[model samples]
Target chain A: MIRAIRSELLKVRTTSLWWLILIGVVAFTAVAIAFNMLATYVTIHPGTVGPQQGGPDSLLTSVTGLYTSGQYAGTLLAMVFGILIFTNEFFHQTATATFLATPKRTLVIGAKLIVAVIVGVVIALITTVLAVGSGLIFLSTQHADLYLGNAEVLKSIGLNWLAFAIWAVFGLGIGALLRSQILSVILGLVAMLIGQTVVQVVLALLSSYFHVKWLMKIAYYLPSSASSIMTSPHGADGFEWWAGALILLAYGAVAAVIGTVITRQRDIS
Target chain B: MADGQIVVTGLTKQFRKVRAVDNLSFTVQPGRVTGFLGPNGAGKTTTLRMLLGLVTATSGTATIGGRRYVDLPDPLRIVGAGLEASSFHKGRTGRDHLRVLCAAAGLPANRADHALEMVGLTPAAKRKVKGYSLGMKQRLGIAAGMLGDPQVLIFDEPANGLDPEGIRWMRTLLSSFADQGRTVLVSSHLLSEVQLFADDVVIIAAGKLIRQGPVEELTNLDGAARQIRVVTPEPDKLFGALELPRTAVAKDENGGFLVTGVTGPQIGKAALAAGVELHELAPQRADLEKVFLELTSGKAGIR
Candidate 1:
């Protein structure tokens, strides 16, 4: 098992995917931190910018948002990393060599799951650092407290890391189930970016038109929504931090089980 | 030689509507190179994949050392197999590719370099596989197969893109592997090449076994019909002497007669009686390519 884990980690390290993903982390988090800093800057000192968008009321909330600015992007990239872990084996036709080296398919997939979580955590860390670094400098320029030592600010960043980790595992499950690199990445991105948001919009519209408040509640159960609840400073309205974490983890658990079972019985050819 | 023997019993694999392998059974002895010969889509690759446990068998068993591949403890150490020629990452260097396998199998990292050196790929070890030519890729595949230095070796179409020297090198390598009391089974369409090194052959056509035996036994199978070459000064006289058998005599390009179903001494006596002086008269042993063609009933895909 240790050998498998080492091999999986090596597999990721040997590919160019890690650095490419880092570039994405920079692109996404840089934009997000820049946007969050501008909003916070305007909120703290009104009349300095264009019409107010009404940013977070408190400095802690503003800094927390700044720290977790790119949680969604981090999680999305983590999922992509997770999907690639499994898909690359088939896409590159290396499944034969991989399975041949370790005949126990479940062990290989399990090792990959561990690597996926590690990768997710790593991506989250980088994004957090980027956001925090950019946010701190921007805050200093605007004559606001850095707030890096605040516990609430720290907790939000911690959850941001946790969100990346969980989403990565969730991505692995999807990759294992799909097995095709292109399809898994595409579908995973679609579900994260458009599918869940589309469902939430439809549910919200239906609830408002029918005056049924219960209809909008279904949207909170979605993976992205659960992720939102866990990564925020104050948990989302629908679920607590732990509940959100559990719900997101449950999706990963189901995917891992189904994926492992399919992979175990699958013929490598 | 004793423990490395492979016994495939009634192995059958059906892929939906297509029956890829049909009750195919063959055993490979450790001390001999066994050639698994077949035509295109003749289930050669499918059978090798089944033996390696890469593909599930619908029925029957393929066991090495009395255990299925999946059940084998430390399979890579026991069985070094290269079932796919191009099962590698394009971005990874050849050394890294073998090292990955070495890591997975718990072998030393140096073994990757050793395997690459064995296949004459030491210089290109640092190059990514995408930069490799077809023959280079084939060598990489063989290098990967030898990574474990196992007791059993299996390769499918291993000589697909090798040059003549490369083919010769592989032939010698496989032959030597078997000679070292290791079981070696190679599936290929190169009949003449297999004829050179294979001790035994398991021939299949359309997913069914057509023949299986020692190379000598399969080639010398009913050797009577293959004529003895007769280059004589009096070709008409010798041809007429063997005319009693009707189809016994065939005209040759050398202005001679090829006599069948008759001993060399009998042909000499017939020539003596006809007063035909012969310059050359030698028995021609049937080549494997011809025998293979006949056994598969001309459906042989011997490349």
Candidate 2:
């Protein structure tokens, strides 16, 4: 097991894919920071825009929302990292050599899962720190409260990191299930970005017209909805923090099992 | 490292509708190079993959030191395999690529450099695999196979992209590896090259073992079928006069009589008895290439 982990880390360290990891860190954090700065500026200079939209309290939520919201951006990047960790082996035909070196296929999968979790947490932390730090700076410039020691704010940030970490594991499962790197990455991005949007849009239309209050109850268990509630607990009809975490955990667990079983049973040829 | 023999018994692999390997069995002993010879799509790669535990065999077993590859504790320290020259990430340097395997095999970090040096790839060790030429990639594959200095080694078409010099270098390397009492099984579709270095040959055709034995023994079996080519001024007279039992005389392309089922000296003695002048008498030796073609073309059955 130790040898497999060492080998997995070595493979990642030596590849040029590290550039992508760096790009993920900078891109996600920069985008979140820019949005927070723009929002904070608009809140301070209300007359500069057409009209003042929300009150200062709502503005404060949006300001800190950057820190928690950046989790999805980091999750996208971490998921890609996780997918590449396994897909690269298949793409390059290194799986043959890997299995030859360590014939226990499950051990290889396990070690890769460990690497994914580690990378996920690291990327999550880096993006979270940058987003929150930049958010604090922008809000302070407008003399708004930093909320540095607020338990709710701190918990949100911590859960945001945890969300990204779990998403990385989910990415590993997806990569294993779909061995094609391009196909898996595209499907992952679509499911994370467009798939969730489509679901939310359909659910809203259904509830608004049909007045099916019970249908919205099931949305809390969806992975994206669960993750959203985990990072921000103030949403309507959202599951509790523990329930949301369990929902995401369930997704990761199911994906990991399916991925591992398929990988083990399929011939490497 | 003590027991390095490889035994493959009734190994078979079927891919959905097609059978890639069909009850193929062979043994490779230590201290000698065995050439796994077959035409393209003849199941050589599939068999090697099963032996290395890359692909699961549908039936039978392949073992080294009386243990399956996966069953062996620390397989790389016992059996090293290069199933394909292209089995590597294109974005990593050769040295780093080897380091990954070394780390998996629990070998020292310096072994990567040593392996690179062994294959004469030290100069390009730091270059990414993408920029490597086909020959360089082949060399790198060999280096990776030898990384652990294992007792048993397997290579599939190791000489596929090598130049004449590179081929010679590989021949020497494989010979030396065998000389150290380590089992080596190198597969190739080229018969001439394998004949140059291999002590034993295992020939397969259409996913079935056709023939296997020492190189000399296989050639000697064909030696008895050797044809004698005789050049003479009078073709008609020589053809009728040299009447041999079960011997057929056919007109050659250049107007020489190709006498089969007879030796050179018998032809000479018969010529003297017939009082025919002989300009030239030469024995046509049967090489592995000819026998390989005959075997694969279904002209020769398994022996």
Candidate 3:
């Protein structure tokens, strides 16, 4: 297992895509921090409705949200990172050599999953540093409340990191489910970017028209929706962060199992 | 079979309608080079894939050293299988590519450089594979195969894209591996090249074994069927003397008789008894290329 992980990491490092994605992460994280900071400042007007007491979308919640501004992009990128790591084996045709070295196919996929986690960890760490650094600079300049060392604020930051890690695993699962490089990537991006929103809106509309309130609640379980529970400081649909994490992880686990079983039973030729 | 020998028993791979490999059974012994010959789509690649555990066989079992390839705890160390020359990450350098294999196999990192040197690719070891020509990639694949210095080596078309010079190098490399008492199984369409280096040949056509024997025996080098160019003052007498089962006498350019089914000694004695004076007697053998063509002709069945 250790050797597999090391080998998997080496495979990623040799490719130029890893660093290219890192650059995208850097720029996107910076932009996310700047924009989220501006929104926090605008949403909480100075000398009027300044920093609400402590509920969903309150001043404290908004301020903590600024600290994890990169969560949206971080999660998405981590997911793509996961997708590529697994799909690249087939894309670049390295799976043969990989299996030849370690004939246990599942072990190699397991190693790839571990590599995906590392990618998420790195992305989470980078975004956290950038968002926190920028937020600290903004708060100090205005002499506003920093909300530093607050438990909720700390939890939000940790969850931001956790969200990225989990999303990466989720991405890996999607890649395994759809092994084709172009197909899985396109499907993943579409599902994460538009499919969730479209489905949620349609479900809400149908719920209202049919007077079925339960239909709208189903949106809360969507992978993208559940992920927001971890990164978004505001309590969404009254679901806890841990519940969101579990729901999101469930989707990934199912897909990964299906992918592994199919690969194990199918002929590579 | 015995230790370190590859055994494929009643192996059959059916791909929907077409039987890619049909009840194939053959044993590849250790310490000798066994050439796996077949026409296109003759299941050579599929058999190799199944043996390495890349492709799941529809039926039968392929085992090395008395265990399945996947069952081996350290398979790479026990058997180094060479992939297709084109199966490489184009973005990575040859050295990096080998290092990844080493990392996966738990081999030393420096072994990558050693392998590159062994294949004479050290100069371009740092270059990305995207820039490599087909022959260079072929060498790199061989280098990867030699990484473990395993007791068994399996290569599919190891000389597929190599030039004559490169083919000679590969022949030498394979010879040395077998010389070290390692089992080597190579599948190639180059029958003449295989005849030069391979000790034994496993010929398959239409997904079935056509022949399996030593190169010399398959070519009839020791049999009466071996072609012998005969030059005599009386061609009719010599031709009549060589009339035997499985023997044929054909008129040569200078009225000499090319005889089969009768040894040179038998022809000599018969010629002397028949008062046929021989001007020239020489062995003109039919090489493996001829035998392969004859055996595989019309057997591939458009597959």
Clashing pairs in 2: none
What's the DockQ of model 1? 0.76
2 or 3, greater by TM-score: 2
**Fnat of model 2, as a fraction:** 0.87
- List the candidate 3 regions with Cα displacement exceeding 4 Å: A44-57, B221-281
| Per-prediction TM-score to the true structure, in the order listed | 0.94, 0.94, 0.91
Question: Model-by-model lDDT, in order?
Answer: 0.86, 0.84, 0.86
* Tens digits of lDDT, candidate 1, B1-303: 248889999999998888889998889999899999977788899898888888999999999999888887788888888876678899989999888888888999999999999999999999988899989999999888888889999988888888899898988998899888899998888798788779999999878899889999977788564668888877777777767566777788877677778878888888889888889889888788877777777554433
Q: Which residue pairs clash in candidate 1?
A: none
Against the native chain B, each candidate's TM-score is 0.93, 0.93, 0.89
Ranking by DockQ: 2, 1, 3
Query: Measured by TM-score, how close is model 1 to the native structure?
Result: 0.94
Better of 2 and 3 by DockQ: 2
Tens-place lDDT per residue, model 2, B1-303, is 468889999999988987889998999999999999988888888999888787889999998889888898888888878877788899999999999999888889899999899888999999999999999999999888888889998999999999999999989999999998889899998999999889999999878999999988777666545677899887566666666543477678988777777778877887787788999998876788877886678622332
Which 10-residue span in candidate 2 chain B carries the lowest summed lDDT?
A: B294-303
Please list all clashing residue pairs in model 3, or write none if there are none.
none
| i-RMS for every candidate | 0.9, 0.9, 0.9
lDDT, residue A153, model 2: 74
